[model samples]
Target chain A: MDISFTSLLWGFLLIIIPTYFLHHYRTGLVKDTLIAALRMTAQLFLIGFYLKYMFDLNLWWLNVLWVIIMAGVASQTIIKRTNLSLRQMFVPITIALICSVAIIDIYFMGLIVRQDNLFETRYFIPISGMILGNMLSANVIAMNTYYGVLRRERTNYLFRLANGASAHEARSPFMRDALIKSFNPTIASMAVMGLIALPGTMTGQILGGSDPDVAIKYQIMLMISIFASSLISVLLTLALTHHKIFNKYEMPI
Target chain B: MIQFNNTYFIYDEKPLISGFSVNIARGEKVVIYGPSGSGKSTLVHAILGFVQAEQGEIIVNNLPISPDSINEIRQLTSWLPQDISLPYNSVRDMILAPFEFKANHSRKPSDQEILAEFDKLKLEHNLLEKGITEISGGQKQRILLLTTVLLRKPILLLDEPTSALDAQSVDLVINYLKSLTDTTIIAISHDEKFINAFDRKLLIGQF
Candidate 1:
């Protein structure tokens, strides 16, 4: 099923269509898009080779170490994308992602898949990557929304606090707003999932020669794990980082 | 009772309030008058620990305003900020919102008590059920004032409470506030009538 270099070069030719449209429309994104596509190709090729070697070795500790590295990169990406203070957010976000990914990995591989080795390369790496990828976007949306709402609605928060609300009570509204905003898109996509769009995991599995029934089951479980992990990680990140963002009087510093 | 003893506040690396001192007795109704940018509101905010004094001490009800005592100080105070944003959909929800907090749960007002305040504030009975967006600014101001009143806290801080009200509504509000003999009322206002209605007037930033 391996595509030769000649076939991949032909695939790269498709970029001309986007480049032409971007240039003709005066969008000024042609250079940036070209650079981005090149970077993507290079990065994926490197990862493809690396993953091949790691999978061949199939060492459990190596698999765990790779997942930990993924969690760290995901945490850093979330912080950078959300425009939060990395020094304040990095450890909390990293710990939250690690904890959530570990929980889902244990539950999925141990109980559900009934695999003897929970850290098997095939089960551990891809499952952890999928869950972490989903969590990265969810945490970005949640942290962005939470901090944005808190800043925009400072008066509302102060009003509640001045009128005898505890810090938790005053902050609950912002938390509620963040949760709703972050989850709405995910929930909507879940609702229309197989009907309008074939999800990536399901499509990949089907193309990879997995049975349709098995692929759908895996997709279902992956979606559930993603939802759970994202929720747990977002709550944990907020809980851990709350003191860093607010002062002793529960005011945003 | 509240006391600001030789307090100083710095904003934007400048002294907005320096060496300012004031003592408000229990059950006193005091109005603070000053020109714009005189830090009048900041003075009241210091009581609730929203603005920390760079120097000196602030005492509220015998407890110093500090990180440790701010919650207790706020629990005893009800504040109406100058600019209002209604997070609730209806007036009734806004009125009951503060009471829903655990700190204020014990003092939750009854329906009759709320209706009584609505009557006194000259707000219509139907307005309670109306959407917050449907109410006029004056009505919104009165509704917020009513909420603070209903809290029955020992200290009340009103920042520009009558800015949106008409002369008649202002009179009604002043009269209602005058009736609360046990509350320490510290109001910031430029309205001559509002200043006259209070028991004492302190001109801030004259120096």
Candidate 2:
């Protein structure tokens, strides 16, 4: 079912419409768009070859290592996107991502999928990647909102602390704001999922020859896992980094 | 209950308060008055460990203001900062927030007690139900003042507390604060009425 090179080239031709609009509107996005498309194609092809080889080999340790690598990359991306200090944030975020992804992957592959080998390459790698990728966006939004509010409303925090609030109590309001902001979009998307949009994971499975019924069930479980992993990772990252980011006096560093 | 011994504070690489020395006794109401950027606010904040003294030490309730004793010091004091921006929908929520803290759990004021303070501060009973955004600047200031008073802390640090209040409201606050016989009050204010009402006055940045 793979498309031939000629057909793929035809698919690349579809980018011309967007390029024409960019040029006509003087949006200055033509070069950026073309470069991004080229970069995406190159990266996907490289991963495609790597995954093909990995799936054929199907070694447990290799699969675990790959998932760890994905989590590391996702953590680094979250730190960079949030514009937080890498030295302070990288380890905590990486640890949080790895731990949360491992929990969800185990629950999905062991209990639900019931694979003879829990670390089966096909189930382990893709499922972990999906969870990590979804979590990256949520962590970025949550961290940004949390730190932004704390920084902007510093006086409010100090007011609470001076009025006899513990450090945890003072930070509760900011944490509430972050959680609400990060989860609202996901909640809305989940509510209108089937009616408004066919999710990317479900569509990919259906196209890959999975039965529609099976694909739908997988998609449902995936949505739940994404939400769970995101919540756990966001909380973990905040907890792990809290001491580092605050002074002994409970003021933000 | 508060001592500053030759304390120095630096902000932005410049000495803001240099070699300052003061010993405030318990139950004394002291007023600090000076021009803007004179470090008057910073001096009060030093006691809370919000701004550290660059060269000297501050002691509150006989405890040195350090990381180890900061929580203990804060638990004994209530600070109403110059810039008050609370994250609460209604005035009552803001007033009640501090009581929810574990440190202040035992000091939760009764509704009657809160209403009495509200009346003393000239705030109407219905003001508590209004959203914070719906209240005026003066009302917001009084409401914040009421919260600090309700904590019943032994030390009160007020920074320009009456800046937004009218003359009548200012007198109400001054009289209420003056009546606290066992509380040590350290305030920064430019209001002549507020300055005159204090038991003693210290002009900062003069030396």
Candidate 3:
């Protein structure tokens, strides 16, 4: 079912059709597409080798350490995409992601699937990666929306405070705004999941030669895990960091 | 009562107010007037702990405005900032929003009280059911004033409260505010009528 190196190289021939069309139409994207294809191939090849060895070793500490690395990189991505100060957001985002991903991964491995080896690298790493990857988008949306709106409508926040609202009461609307903006896309995706598009995890599982039924079950589990992880991570990060974002007078810092 | 005891405030390393002293007594209506960016609004913000005074102290009702006491002081004072930013909710929700806070939960205004204040401010009772965006600027300004009155705080800091009002509505609002003899009022305004109605007027950017 897998293509060898020669077959994969032969697959490169298919790119000529799109490249010729792009060049003829002056789309200006042929170079970018080719470079992106090259980068993807290189990165995936490197990771394939790395993951093979790591999975072979299958040490618990290694799995945990790898997940921490993933969380760290995810935190960097979240901060960069949200245009927040890295120093201010890094630790909070890292802690939030780690706590959420670990909790969900543990629940999935130990309780839902009840694997004999709960910390098996194959089970923990991919599941944790899936959850972490999904959380990055939600975190970016929530933090960006919350801080962006707060900056734009600072007077609105202060007006609420001037009306005798406590800090929590004053901030509740913005928090609700962030949560709704971030969660709506995921919720919409969930509503149309199997009918409109086959989810990534299910497709990957089927490609890896698992039974279709098993792949469907895994996809549902992974989707739920992603939803739970994203919710917990965004809320926890916001709760932990909101105090630092404002001055004593509840002004945006 | 509010007192600025030799207060000093700096913005971007430039001193805006230094060794400034002013005392507003109970029930006294004081108007602060100055050119824009002359730190008049900063003075009001300083009283609320939004702008830090580099030296000296600002005392609201004899309680210093500091990080620890800001919440308590804010609860005792009602402020109408220059921007009358109202939520997109119905007029009733906007007016009743303050009561939803824990500090003011017990001080919730009755419908009759709201109606009375609305009548005094010349607001139509039917506006309560309309969204805040549906109201005119003058009407919204009056609604904001109505909210301040409903808060029933002992001290009031109003930044250009009548800037958006017409001549008649301005008079109506200023007269209604003047009638609140029990409240200490500190206002920032350029309107001669509003300033003349005050007991004292302090000019910023000079001694």
In model 1 chain A, the worst 10-residue window by lDDT is: A177-186
User: What are the fnat scores of the candidates, in the order listed?
Assistant: 0.87, 0.91, 0.83
Give residue A182's lDDT in candidate 1 (0 to 100). Answer: 80
DockQ of 1: 0.85
DockQ of each: 0.85, 0.85, 0.75
Candidate 2: segments with Cα more than 4 A from true spot = A18-30
Question: Candidate 3: deviation at residue B6, Å?
Answer: 1.0
**Tens digit per residue, CA lDDT, model 1, A55-107:** 89999999989988999999999999988889988898898899989998999
Badly placed stretches (over 4 Å) of model 3 are A6-37
lDDT (0 to 1) per candidate: 0.91, 0.91, 0.88
Q: lDDT tens digits, residues B1-207, model 2?
A: 999999989999998988999999999999999888899989888888888999888999989988999989999999999986776899888899999999899988888888999888888999978898999999999889988988999999999999999999899989989988899999999999999998799898764
Candidate 3, B106-205: lDDT as tens digits: 8899888889998998888888888877889888888888888788998888999999988898889889989999998889998988888877999998
Q: What fraction of the genuine interface contacts, i.e. the true contacts, does candidate 1 reproduce?
A: 0.87
Q: Model 3, range A51-72, lDDT digits (tens) per residue? A: 8998999999998999999999
What is the number of residue pairs that collide in model 1?
0
